[model samples]
Target: MQTKKYTRLMLASTLVLAAHAGWASDEGTLTMGTSVNYSSGKYGTQTSTDITSIPLNVAYDKGPWTFKVSVPYIRITGPSDVVVGVGKTSATTSTVRTASGLGDVVTAATYNFYNNAEAQFGADVTGKIKFGTADSAKGLGTGENDYSVILDVYKKVNQLTFFGGIGYTALGSSAAIPLRNVFSLTAGSVFKMDEKNNAGFAYDYRQKSSATSAAQSELTAFYVHKFDKSWKTQTYLLKGFSDGSPDWGAGVSVGYAF
Candidate 1:
């Protein structure tokens, strides 16, 4: 969701500059950011698990395209069956232990292919790859690459912007841990409070990626503030409605543009 929101902001900025010189920009933008996220849940288990991650992200926006990368440091305290982001796995052990190490690395590219300023509508296509950089022995991630693609669209009316997206993911699998491909959906709206501040809420749903896991449904509320053209920050809180999601989660991020 964080990455998707960034793409939306890029589109909005592109629209603002469109009248000056077409839809694509003459000068590219580079952005960097970091976020800290924490989540805790039982995930259909008898004991609760806690997960924390701090990720570094960077992006380059040129013309109507955006390229991004993210790498994270993760800490987990849970049973062996619980996987970060993926929830319960097929492991039969219930032993709880703490582990900390590098997490998976994700890369993505987004292309804005359609825009109508007068009608206040825009759309983008994005493809992502998640590399298995995390240590599978420690259960940080599946030691195989995963791929996904998404289509996002938005419309603006007055002080509000409505957005939605649909995506499909091809999960990586191994003989010991077979996985399932799944579809995901997201929808949300942002209310502009002023030139520098805005708040929004989003709902996300995803099909189960493993037979042992339940489908995921989560809702998040977020606020973003811009201090200047080159600096901004965001904070969010989320609640889960299914065992595949965290019972509750919160995160904060700060970004700089160059």
Candidate 2:
């Protein structure tokens, strides 16, 4: 069953790539990126737990639509008490558990419903799917699929852009943990420092997945530098404000567009 699931995911990804490659034009752009991230502290536990993940992303944009897909490989080193989804464990064992494998396959499609080039404002809706590609036995994922929908709006004024969004996610349930549907909100602004440099900050809040768990909140600052018309690099730092999130995290990514 696992083999079949992976095979289907790969096939779907390949088909999307092929379709985009054939349809790409001057009006459309394709971008590829890779990122690595590390974070420590599980839930509210003072335990020394950490997670590392490396993800590969592909995105395509054309006209008023955008499509994205991501595949991640992740490693978790910590006590098994750190339950997935709930983000907390009651066990006090000093023995750490390590798990590594493909994490999850995510795909999204966005359609711009409104745009005003002269006014520099636009709104879009995105639908996303999270496939359970990770090995459940390895504790990489919950072996269940999730879905979400988000609405985003942005406006540009001079060199600064303001954006915000809200979304609802239908969390998948596993034998080990039961999750509830959650709502999330994000708000931020970005400033273009020059032709090649940009900086932004965002705050995110999410409802708790379980009644016993606290809601999650985080703040992130990001910077992007364009190496050329076709290449760019991005880096970010994150600080979590709730037990359901990592205490601190950082990552860097390089992207190429064509």
- Tens-digit lDDT track for model 1 on 209-247? 888888988887878889998898888887889888888
**How high is the CA lDDT of each candidate model?**
0.75, 0.68
Count of backbone clashes, every candidate in sequence: 0, 1
The window of 10 residues in a row where model 1 has the poorest summed lDDT is 13-22
- The model with the greatest lDDT is 1
In model 1, the Cα lDDT at residue 178 comes to 78
Winning candidate number (TM-score)? 1
What TM-scores do the predictions have?
0.91, 0.86
Instruction: For candidate 2, write residues 139-192 as lDDT tens digits.
Output: 676677889898877777887877878889898886565678888887777878
Instruction: Report the Cα lDDT for candidate 1.
Output: 0.75
The runs of at least 3 residues in candidate 2 whose Cα sits more than 4 Å from the true structure, single-residue gaps closed, are: 1-26, 83-86, 89-95
